[model samples]
Target: MTPRIVYLATADARGHLMRAQLLVHALRQAGAQVDVITTSDAGQRFLAGFGIEASILSHHYAMQFDTRQNMLRGASNRNVLHYMVHPARMLRDLLRLRRTLRGKDILVNDSFHPAALFMGILPVARRKVVHVYGGSLREAVLGNFDGTKRRLFSHLFRHVVGWQIDAARARLEHDFSYAISDHAKGRDCSLPTPVQVAGPPPADGLNSAAIYLNPHFSDTNLAHALCEGIADAGLAAYCVGEGYAGNDGWVGVDPNWASRAAHAEVIVSAPGMAALSIAVVYGRPIILVLTEQPEQASNAKRATALGIAHQTVTWRGEAHDFRCQVRQAASTLRRMVPAPTAVSSGRLQAQARVDAWTVRLLALCGVQT
Candidate 1:
């Protein structure tokens, strides 16, 4: 039986999508039949760029926001009503998803909790849940339902939750469950325990600086502003991402961003595991712009604690001030003379473990190629 694996990744962040993309590629390279599902539109394109087509789920989870553009609430009944009005499409989408997951050999959950909920309700054959843990499981599970949902679903909801919990326990014990960072186990936060894996290496880059920002920051124009400031300082700055496009022809979100990152003297970006992993490759100085999201904030804390990067609370400041920070960072990079570098043995071991897992999954599918 050729292994039919389904990768369900929350497309809420770029890091999640990119990480899933890499995993999907490795699986395909190993000759496994892989299907992908995500909740983000950009994520669909991101996966497509790598030749892996994905199914976009019309996520019914409502997000509460204010004038300042913060996620005041996540997945509430207050927002579900709007989508529920379209009963026909909602039912169709649910059925479509059910059909997709009913008989997969392996199901990989990259911090996508909705899959767990579906697993609870839908009868999935060979229901092997391989969780790629990233965010707080507590928040993901607890945040999905408010008081109204609990009272509405009644005891049936509790039973479903129990199944989800059992699935999580099974996933944790399973070898396929992976935690992206080597230090994830030590964090006393919302992260989970699993095989600690390192990030993929970027292409060999120059001695200049590069900035990779999440689309979330596009709301405030901070990502773009930082790029402009860096360029204004007469430094080599490659900004990889949209919203910051054109950038007065300074840079565009390039597909070969890793290659650009490989040459940079330092990196300025959000604390995504994938981006952080690239920075870790050559011990590049990272100016981490912290986000309120637990997973990213946790990554930033761990990176700073390990002496991997400097933390900035926000990307707010005048253009001149931002330029001064860039100049200072470059100066510090130069003063240091010889570049310092180190890679965790755990990270290296993690990389190897993932490769082995890929081979094992392929074998399970009875594919000898």
Candidate 2:
């Protein structure tokens, strides 16, 4: 029998949407009927850009970020608390979710969603959930309490999250490398990050740098600095992200940004797992624009440690200072020896991981692959 799958994707970042897009495509191609529900209208539009239709669940939570893309912890905490405790919103969403899950074979939760996590506590829902997330998420949650102040809180939080993770029937924790093993279960396995395969490069040769910033980044001066830096490094720039549309000299929110990144000489973007995965699969050296976001910072650090040729730049309150840093990083990365076999090898590895994951997912849904 063909399995019916309900995928709940959070909209806090584009990574979740992209992951949903890729996995849903793969599952559909494998003959599973997949229905996607995202957290916000923005997410619905994003998926639409890729020719995927998704419904928006009105009860959604978002993290608070400053104009410069710094995560505002206190404000974010308050927001989550409100979303969790609001009686009307919570009750409405839970009822909607229960209805949605009815007759569905499995629920695939991409990253975390408070409502879905709550629903999974019920015996019926608990047996039908498959959670997908990156290792950086685990680090980010625990890393929040890293230094001298809250050791006990950190310890208790770790236990709580661990138990929460086990609420699902199966979990797929993905990362660039498989280094950590917690011995959860055979069903809970770690695998390489999954990314969409790039299409053939355009007829014109690949010589431009592709830049992507999430909707959270809205600083105009930083965009200008990036344009100047790319020009100074003597490379053409294709910039895409929210708030960049119609900007002078910016390509602005191109749906084909991934293809551009695939063929580009280098990639410039925040260190989101989706972007990082694209860079790795295409063997494109990247310049990571980092902020105080723990997940991104941890991803950048891990990318460097994994010997991926990359550079990091941060906003230091002045566009001039940032321009110089970007220019230097771009120039340095552009001159590095290109990995001739990296593209084929990387693509093969990603394809294998995705294929393995899809098979397991189908099996869990009681569909023979």
Candidate 3:
């Protein structure tokens, strides 16, 4: 029987949607029927960019972030609380989800979603759910409460999240390393971070730098600073991200961005798992533009420690300072020599990993490959 799968991807960052895109494409190619549900309209548009159709759940929740990319804890809490108490929207969306999942063989929850989490608590719905997430994402959720004044609330919420994870039929944790054996002993199987395979590098040679920022960095001044910085290094910038859509000079919503970045002299992006995975596979040196995002900050540290040719530039509200930092990072990374084996070896390993994951997923859904 063909496995019928419903993937629920939250759109807090593009990484979740990107992961969903790869997995959904793989599943469909393998003759599985896959339907996608996202938390917001932005996610719908993002999936659409790759020619994938996704429906938006009416009762969606989102984290609040400022134009500078700092998480607004107070605002986020209030928003979530409001959503939780709204009986009408919550009941309606839950019904929508129940209807969607009726004939599906499995429900894959990428990262987290409140509605899915709630459904996982039900005995009937819990059996069909398989939660997918990365190590950084797990850390980010726990790290958010670290050192906060609300210690009791933080502890309780952590336990709540733990319970939700325990409720899933299975958990698939993915990372950006070759060591999948270490995590194969339990329900939590660590797979390689799934990313789209890159085509051959540009025949014309590396011509420009690729910059990708997520929608959180909506400050126009930051975009201007980034453009100036890349120009200062005498490299043309091929910028991607909804945040840069308003900037007339940058390319926005390019579905072929990974290919473009594969040909870049260097990749400049926020250290989201999707972007980082692409950089590693393509063997491109990267400059991680950091903000107050805890997950991204932790990811940047890990990437640097792992010996990736990586640099970091934290925003401090000064356009001039940020511009200078980007210029310096870009200039330095452009001169670094990328390993010859990095591209070919990484690409092959990544493909193998994704294939392994696809097979496992199919088996979990009772589909004979």
Query: What lDDT tens digits, residue by residue, belong to model 1 across residues 210-295?
Result: 77765554543455556655665466666665545565443434556654564566677766666666666545566766545545
Winner of 2 and 3 under TM-score: 3
- C-alpha lDDT of all candidate models, in order: 0.55, 0.80, 0.81
Per-candidate TM-score against the hidden true structure: 0.71, 0.92, 0.93
Worst 10 residues of 1 by lDDT: 186-195
Model 3 Cα lDDT, one tens digit per residue, 301-329:
88978998888887788999999998998
Give me the runs in candidate 3 sitting further than 4 Å from their true place. Answer: 178-186, 202-206, 340-342
Model 2, poorest ten-residue lDDT window? 176-185
Q: What is the Cα-based TM-score of model 3?
A: 0.93
Q: How many residue pairs collide in each prediction?
A: 4, 0, 0
Q: What tens-digit string does per-residue lDDT give for candidate 2 at 95-157? A: 888899899998888876777777667788888878888888866765555674779987887
Candidate 2 wrongly placed segments (more than 4 Å): 142-157, 178-185, 203-206
> What residue runs in model 1 are displaced by over 4 Å at the alpha carbon?
59-92, 113-115, 120-126, 135-207, 219-221, 232-234, 250-252, 317-330, 333-369
Could you tell me which 10 consecutive residues in candidate 3 have the lowest summed lDDT? Answer: 177-186
What local lDDT score does residue 142 receive in model 3, on the 0 to 100 scale?
Answer: 60
